[model samples]
Target: MAIEINRITQVNKAALRLPNQPFKRFGTLLVTRTETGWHHQEQLSDQTFEQTFPEENYQLSAIDAAGFALGAFEGSRCVALATFEYDFHFNRYLYLADLKVDPPFRRQGIAANLLNAAEPLAKAHHKRGLCTIAQGSNLGANRFYLAAGFHIGGLNTNDYRFTSQEGDTDIYYYRDF
Candidate 1:
């Protein structure tokens, strides 16, 4: 069956409840993994992927707990995800983080659609704007964000320096709504 994408609207207690039928029947599922202990272990296993952005612990407690999380599901599987948090450094702007699409679902426009869902939510919350940080080595992601209407703001060198991982840079991008 062809895949269909849907956005989750309500979030309660740091959990966004996704529609279950499409996920259950179509094999699309959204999984939220926020356990700091589990994330710490996962990061230790693969520092490269972990240090590409802020750690999951930071995401779970500092961001997800306070902002919005959106997922794109196909059938019962979560094919894409986007997380946003209020950034005080950017004058309380909403920042998008950890936008990811399952490898098998890349090039299907799932990620773009996920970001599309986040735009209005930021506006409704009266945020200054939306921003995202892309890993410097990830050319495709950088290009994708740029094509999706994000402008390059500046470089974030050693952004993940505290991470055990070595040699990575982050680039900041923003879009004014």
Candidate 2:
């Protein structure tokens, strides 16, 4: 069946609580800066490891108030989701706080489709662009963001400092409209 992309309505907002699908990566993307410009290179780790972000409980009201939320469905089942919110922290950009596709539905362009659906909604809100952050160790996500026309705009080297995730970097990506 074809995956349907639809705006998340209040009645079906619960779809945002998708099942956690952990990921494993064999290496991490290392960021460096030279006189020329920022650089990103992948370094293979000694061992493969799985990482899973803590589960998030998104309030229905908050989801409603967000700039937009979309779900990719195969019939009645929601297999993927994307949510964006207006961020004026630095500029008028929509922050893609959440984007996920279940394991069985991945690699079929569902995630990309959701991103395509989000761009117009963001443009409709008069936002300048869309932005998001991915863990440096998540090679697949970093690659996807780059392939989707986003550039590595910045990095937070201290975002995970003093935590279990210390040594992990937060890579920020932005796609200008």
Candidate 3:
């Protein structure tokens, strides 16, 4: 059976009710965020960032406050997530962070869909581009970001200080819309 891309509408409307066949055929998925559901948002936050960074830190909180939280759900189950944070230093830009696809849903183009959804949002906010940081040791993430059209901007030594650990290396990547 051919998967019809047109059947997947970006915006949901009551008149265009998705058929159960298509829902079953494509596995009925939707992308949404925490402001839509407080419980979902809390679960998404706990699952997305708890293992990687200081979950209770002020910086992360600021990021969460300013950022747009996104998640892909199959029915009510959250299968993937990505967050975008727009920041201004030398210029205005957006940072893509905490991109994660559930282990069972990997290689299904979900990440691409999430990114596809983000580009316009960034553009609407007048962002010059999108950026991301990948740990040097995480080769899979490094390759994934690169494959998604993000190019290496630079490498920083002792850039990130997490807890008591010091001198962590992080590679930055950016893509102009």
Clash tally for model 1: 11
- TM-score between model 1 and native: 0.63
Better of 2 and 3 by lDDT: 2
Off by over 4 Å in 1: 1-64, 88-92, 160-167
- After the best TM-score superposition of candidate 1, give how far the Cα of residue 133 lies from its true spot, in angstroms: 0.7
Superposed Cα deviation of residue 91, candidate 3 (Å):
2.5
Model 1, 1-177: lDDT tens digits are 455544444332222322211111111111123543111011112223322232243334454466767777665566666677765364646887567665667788877787777777777878867788766555566667777887766665667687853455666777777
Scored by lDDT, the top model is 2
* Superior candidate under lDDT, 1 versus 2: 2
Winner by TM-score:
2
Model 3 lDDT per residue over 69-88, tens place: 45566764556666677763
Query: 1 or 3, which is superior by TM-score?
Result: 1
Per-model TM-score on C-alpha atoms: 0.63, 0.93, 0.61
**Candidate 1: lDDT over CA atoms?**
0.57
Q: How would you encode candidate 2's per-residue C-alpha lDDT over 1-177 as one tens digit per residue?
A: 989999888767878888668877878888887888779998887998876777888776787676678999998789999888876366878899899889889889998899888888888878888899999988889988988899888889999999987999999998888
- Backbone clash count, each prediction separately: 11, 0, 0
- Sort the predicted structures by lDDT, highest score first: 2, 1, 3
